[model samples]
Target: MAVPGMMRAVEIKAPGGPEMLVETTVPVPVPGQGEVLIEVAAAGVNRPDVLQRQGRYPPPAGASPLPGLEVAGTIAAVGPGVDPGAVGRRVCSLVAGGGYAEYALADHAQCMPLPPGLAMEEAAALPETLMTVWHNLFERAYVASGDHVLIHGGTSGIGTMAISLCRLFGITSIVTCGSDGKCRAALDWGAGHAINYRDEDFVEAVKRITGGAGVDAVLDMVGGDYLPRNLQCLAEDGRHVSIAVLGGAKAEILIPQIMTRRLTLTGSTLRPRTSAFKALLVDEIMRTAWLFVAEGTLRPAMDRIFPLAQAADAHSRMEAGEHVGKIVLKVR
Candidate 1:
């Protein structure tokens, strides 16, 4: 299969508001060695995209300038070292950028088959969030069965996924939410207790739930003022993984507390990952997690979807923090 000459894409002209996103025609990218061309059907919206829009984040060297990070589509072409027959298969791929386009290039190793009941939109939403959660929870934090886990931003995509993953793995979970509605949502998703951060301190709530011992691990996206509180909510030998600094990145952490409690703080990003690393992740998902997804135990909680041209509107909505789950963009 041969690649096309050009395709439609959403390009960001400059760092600013949602209005900065512009629709443009760009030459369709040809896949390099070990790569495939994806005829994108949908793309996922994430906080990184918002940060890129605001000029805080930029694509790494040798990556696309476009905003999108993950996409779902049919393979349009396969490059050298890839099976050309793979061109026709349906796949959702993790991308460094350029998923906002009607066509994008991805390494064959980064592509995952669509979940049985998932649409392109839902498939688009899965890669980034799932990769983040799995990497942070199981890989870095090593959340074990019956481990008391505390999750922040209970209504967000990461939070929803964390709640389900914790339940699926037999980890008792507590969550922090901004409102009663979000707290209820987290509870329904299998969280043991929900702290409305608006009305109460999650540190107190977590300590109370843990019988004053505190949680075994914490997944914190809320930084800044929550830093000290997060540490307080962790038990001896607990780990705290911060995936996002929504509040603020800088924090004054207690070194003695970390040493005394034997705590490990770590996090990683989906983008800037080595192809070999992601290939292993894809293999893990296919071998183990695919069955759960097929059985509906592990599934993406899809939210609002917008057409490719409406990327700006979608970004604006997500930045406003009104969404309850993953937001997707239909790139077709």
Candidate 2:
């Protein structure tokens, strides 16, 4: 494969709305040490990308300023110290940035080979959400088979993935969605229970659904007032893992609730983690979750696909919150 010197990419013209994402020609990025250059086939659109577009979340130091977190493609070239044989291999990788382009650079260790049956678009959708859910739900929350979990945003990419994984692992998922249709979609996706938060109280629904025992864990992406309410939905020794503060960053919690019930609250942001840590996460996922991918039993619930040039529209759909699953941009 021949690498290009310049490539088309979407750049943030300024911090603002989806319209700020402008297509332009820029020098293709070179892979640094321990990295490989990927000829991007597709890229996943995530909440962080939207935040970056709005200038709320800035790229970490030394990371790409462009807005893409995950991509799936073929290796076109390798940097120093990387195996030359890696070129031409199909892979999906989690990148810190720069995936909204014709080509992107990814850390070699962060790359996961795309199984024969997986589409590039599906592969592109997996990395960021997969890692976040795997680490938080399984690793941090310590959920096990038969455990009941409460997840917000039931129809979102992360929520759907969590529901699927919980089903595969024998855990039960109780999810909250904004609409009745989304709740139905979540149940069809194998969530044990779905609550339309707009119509009913999720805390009360979880209590009723669990026979007043509550859930073993809460996978919360919505913070603010929901924090205290989330605590009210947890069972004894239940874990609360906050992955995003979409509702609000600050919340007032009753310390007595946590202390009396032996509850645990924890959260993480993936982008700033060391490459070594992410590499280890990649390895772990390959050993465990990758088997489901290889068997064709696990795949992302895709919502929409947009051409690379229509990056703004892709972001627009994601922001509108009508999407039921992952939204991706086709770069090929």
The CA lDDT of each predicted structure is 0.86, 0.96
Write the residue-wise lDDT of candidate 2 on 132-157 in tens digits.
99999999998999899999999999
Q: Model 1 scores what on Cα lDDT?
A: 0.86
What is the Cα-based lDDT of residue 218 in candidate 1? 88
For 76-144, candidate 1 gives per-residue lDDT tens digits of: 988899987897898888898998999988879989976567678878888888888888888899888
Question: Lowest lDDT 10-mer window, candidate 1?
Answer: 288-297
- How well does candidate 2 score on lDDT at residue 96? 96
TM-scores, one per candidate: 0.96, 0.99
Q: How many clashing pairs per prediction, in order? A: 0, 0
Candidate 2 off by > 4 Å: none
